[model samples]
Target: MDLPRYPYHQSLEQRSGQPQRRPVVIVGAGPVGLTLALDLAKRDVPVVVIDDSDRIGEGSRAVCWAKRTLEVFDHLGVGEAVAREGVRWQRGRVFHGEREAYAFDLLPEAHHKMPAMVNLQQDQVEARLVRAVQLEPRIELRGRHELIGLEQDADGVTLNVRTPDGLFDMRADWVVGCDGARSPTRTLLGLGFAGQVFEDRFLIADVRLAPGVRPRGLDPATPERWFWFDPPFHRGQSVLLHAQADGLWRIDFQLGRDANVDAERDPERIRARVAAMLGSDGFELVWSSIYQFCCRRAERLRVGSVLLAGDAAHQVSPFGARGANSGVQDADNLGWKLAAVVKGEGDDVLLDSYEFERIEAADDNIGHSTRATDFISPKSALSLRLRKAALDLAAHTDFAKPLVNSGRLSLPTAHVDSPLSTADAEVWTSGPGPGCPAPDAPLDEGGWLSEQFGRGFVLLAFGWPVQAPGLRVITLPAEGVAATRYGARPGSVHLIRPDAVVAARWHRFDAADVAAALARAHGRPQ
Candidate 1:
């Protein structure tokens, strides 16, 4: 499929030779930046999104969009389209050599609005996000408008941008760097990534099978993630296979540190690898590349009025699908808080919470990614022997299955330690707690519980008539999935943040208590 190219036009600031200050200026018109722009626009906050490139990137860089990311995308107005167009799968099979070790399911439970994971090419994902941004009136997307330099003061940030017409200056109350790992915005802010780089490399090939051709021993119609450790075709190495939309299959072959990078990138060599595994050559190589991944994050997520997000803030190995998934979550975490601060409903304290929560999340992802990398590519012979033993025992022993880490897979991390969460004053046996993403349940009325939350605080009152001034209060019967998931009983109340995180919950409703918890959620001292 041909990638859509967004037209680049000279900005008004460049045409009029006067700087315009925007509420939020997002650098990089990729998925993260565009998602943030749409999110902020939904909050009635105007945003200017600029990118150095006018076209979607070439390769299928990120293929796995997790459930939490899909939920975030749903609010941005592209969730339905993404889910429909992407391949949905939950089952994954892990293989040790030629034998199957075990299988796992990502979403064992049902009734959620979105699936466990969706595999859509990165380019297609960006195309959908770009179209969404275009439809939103409050978001101004300017392609080929690059940020040359930026200076931040107490009040706002001044950015020097280079456009097709000429150089221009623009100001923003806040600047977000969604540009990739080598982010220019991050460079300008003098931030550095502090983490470890894995000593192994991987070769990725996106292939489209010819007519009537299918992978050996696998149903092409069924989508499943396949990970192999020391496979027969690729001995002493790990391989990952993911089925994507539009007949595209993403395959990653582990290449040790001393492998020839250029030679491995050859189309014929990649084709040979695919043929060796599938026992068929009736496939066209769509894209191929070699990369060495790292589990690293920026020194700081925020510096004054400028903030870093997406790959600019953190990076992880592709093993767990953490990179793009976590980046989109960053947008979800920041959108409402930044909008509140920009609209004068919140202060610096509220915005700073984004830094704390996302940094914590980043560290968690980095740690997991690091562990996956180490297990996949053990540096020493002793570690390799241990990994082999673990895999050998995993097939028959339940105890050793946990030791086999073929990328733990991506799952949303709850900010249970966040300072924004109010301590639970009551005990609950079930349901999400403070600083946890609100679990979706099939409402007795019809739609899912998440469909009712908006871009503001939501108060879920169970079996009681409760009203909180200026808050969306949802009254529900204390039964069914909603009650079961929330552990809701008579007079139980839960305060949900704009991002659908549980800020606080109580056994009974009290307007004053709800108000105080809401204040704490907004970074105001109760």
Candidate 2:
């Protein structure tokens, strides 16, 4: 497949004298920024996305997109292309010295719209998103525009952006940072990025297998991931193998802090490592990089009119594919709230939920990544002994299998205590609760319930509309997956927020109660 290049395009009408003002100015047009732009545009809020790149990034970075991210992409209108072009996998295996230690399945459920994970090249994913952004009427994507400076105050933010033409000042009601680890937006805010930096550096590379080449023991037909804990080929280090789209494979090798970064990245050296593991050096190396990443987050995600999302908001080690996946979810969570605030339908304080909920999510992912990293690359001899004992025991003992953590993988974070939730008025069984992403189900007519979301705040009613425009109602019969998933009675109701999170639910429907819940979701005082 040919690579994708996004030519620089200037869609925003330039301000010659006074800088033009927009509702939202997004910096960095990666997956998260593009998703936010499309999302806000769908909500009828205009957005301007600024990025320095003229093309999708090279290589397959962040290839493991999780299922929940795919669901959010469906609402953004690019999920079909992603699901069609990506390689789907759920099962994975962990090996300890050539012996299979354990095998696991990520998504055991059968009815999900997408699989547990999809391995698509980062460039391909960005290309699809770029196409969507270009076609969106309400979004202006300015490529090769560098955000050199930002200043925020009471009403809005002023950004000094440098384009190929020249530097110009622009203003927006809000400025969002989707910039990666080193964020200019974060720097402008003087935020203290705090977290632990792991001592080990990782070598990540993508390689295309020859027409008939198969790694010594890997099955070209199977999509399962294989992780090694102290493998024979790599000696003390751990390695990860993933099958990607287009007959490509991603290999991650752990290099201790002392490893010479330059020497380790040489093509011949990397090729020799692959030959050691695969018993052949026929694969063509596509890209290789040596870098150290930390699991950290900004001191705060929201600071007045300027906010952070994606890598700019927080970061985690690449072990669990938590970085990009969580970043996409961050954009999804903030888009509706920001749109509401901009359109006067919600209080500006509604943006608080973005900070509270996503920070909670960031902490959760950091905790998982930290534990996975420790397990993968033990810091001390004691830790190494324990990890090895566990992996070795996992080969024969079921109890030990549960202890092996080759990255817990990524799972949707439930915002159980979000301030936006109204708490269940009464007890209910089954289905999701307040602050949980709505449980998707097959409609009695043979579609998905989540497919009906992202259209703004709506009520999940088992029967009919209960007379509230603010809570637009959708009826589902009391006898099917919808009923079982929602735990709803014939007349019960569920208030789902615009972002598809449950704001509240009740065993009985009442217009007055649902209205109050809707207001609460918008950050209106009770």
Candidate 3:
């Protein structure tokens, strides 16, 4: 359901004489902004999201969502909706010289409930998030509102916004910028976004399927599959196909270096490319455009009272499906911390960890995307030959198949050095370590690790246990499911945070030590 727009005067009056500003103001209504708003709102934190666009655009930009991002969406209560509309691909086939060269199936069915990746257009994703945001009364989504400037002090941030009518100011305890790569908020903070830009350009077109011509390698009736054609446009071109729920397909092709922008605008050229790629499969072009890829990182993610998330902070080439996934992860990392500080559960120091953790994740993503891009589109003769040789060898070697398909190419985050992780503890066979998510395993009472613990502290007690005040501890039998899953041995304990990351572990299960660790993890002194 679309939200009714508020009159400019009414909005201004509501801001006047407000005793308490929201804990955070998120600028930009993209998936990152909306996801952060919903996450914080669920935690009972007041949040407002502002976007310059009055409505979601029709452009089909981001097309793939990673498995980790699907988990985050599930936590936000929109995963099922996404899954219903998304196209799931469990297998990928690589072709060389117009013949199938390599094929790899993703993780076996036992490893995941869904496929490793899904094909869902960014516009549809925005729609789902918008619906979820509207259902949350605490989350205010203001359209046609732009953040012009902001000033922050020790306590809060006062922002100047320009709406369709005029200018006004709103205050928040913290400000988050999710406003994309050319972020005005990032500019105001004097942050530098530095990186390398690939000079190659690509044209993207979203089109409807014609009567007989259907996308190759995917069933026309199934909308959950994607097709990638290498040497896409010609010898040096690439084409990506994403099937949409509405019987539409998105096609992306690399433009020849000699091609001009006018070449992209020519519908005949696009149709010819699509026809050639589809090979007798017909399609009608709906929309088309061209873009250049870049691999860049923000020098700093935080500047005083303002913080950056999503594309606003960093950008990666659209390879390995990193940009949208990384941005959503950034929102997940920052949302809870913002809520904790606002509710007086933690100090500002807790906010600093956002930069520490997300910056590292961004760096990992950039490296992964850069390598993937280089592998797919090698720039030099030597690199091209190397990639082809590696692919050729993989085609002949059974042992090398997994390496090519692991998509482990998208690096997972480990919080080994995060200040939030508790160190200097005896190694435990049963509990979670710092910077690690609690492993999913069965409980004694026919439950799961996520089912046993709510979005708060979970203390796992194995073997003989001692009582601790203000903590939720679940005792398990010796060598039981919990012990096996969390690597917990007898007489050990684990402290897990709401985000499911293990805060600390102890082998002895000493009440005093456990108390101190929990206090520190929760940002309180014992």
Best by TM-score: 1
Which candidate ranks first by lDDT, i.e. highest?
1
Q: lDDT by residue for model 3 over 169-241, one digit each (tens)?
A: 8888889999999999999888888998887778888888777666664676644334343544356555656
Superposed Cα deviation of residue 167, candidate 3 (Å): 1.0
Clashes of each: 0, 0, 12
Candidate 1 vs candidate 2, lDDT winner: 1
User: Sort by TM-score, best first: what order?
Assistant: 1, 2, 3
- Please, what are the lDDT tens digits per residue for candidate 2 over residues 155-269? 7899998877777888999989998888989998999999999879889878887877887567867688899878889998889999888888999998888999889978999
List lDDT for all candidates, in order: 0.89, 0.87, 0.74
Location of the lowest summed lDDT over 10 successive residues in candidate 3: 1-10
- The worst-scoring run of ten residues by lDDT in candidate 2 lies at 8-17
- lDDT by residue for model 1 over 54-132, one digit each (tens)? 9898888999999989988988778889999999999999999979888999999989999999999999999998888
lDDT of 2: 0.87
lDDT of 3 at 261: 80
Model 1 spans > 4 angstroms off: none
List candidate 3 segments past 4 Å from native. Answer: 1-10, 13-20, 109-115, 210-214, 220-233, 398-411, 424-433, 441-454, 461-468, 474-485, 489-493, 506-508, 523-526
Clashing pairs in 2: none
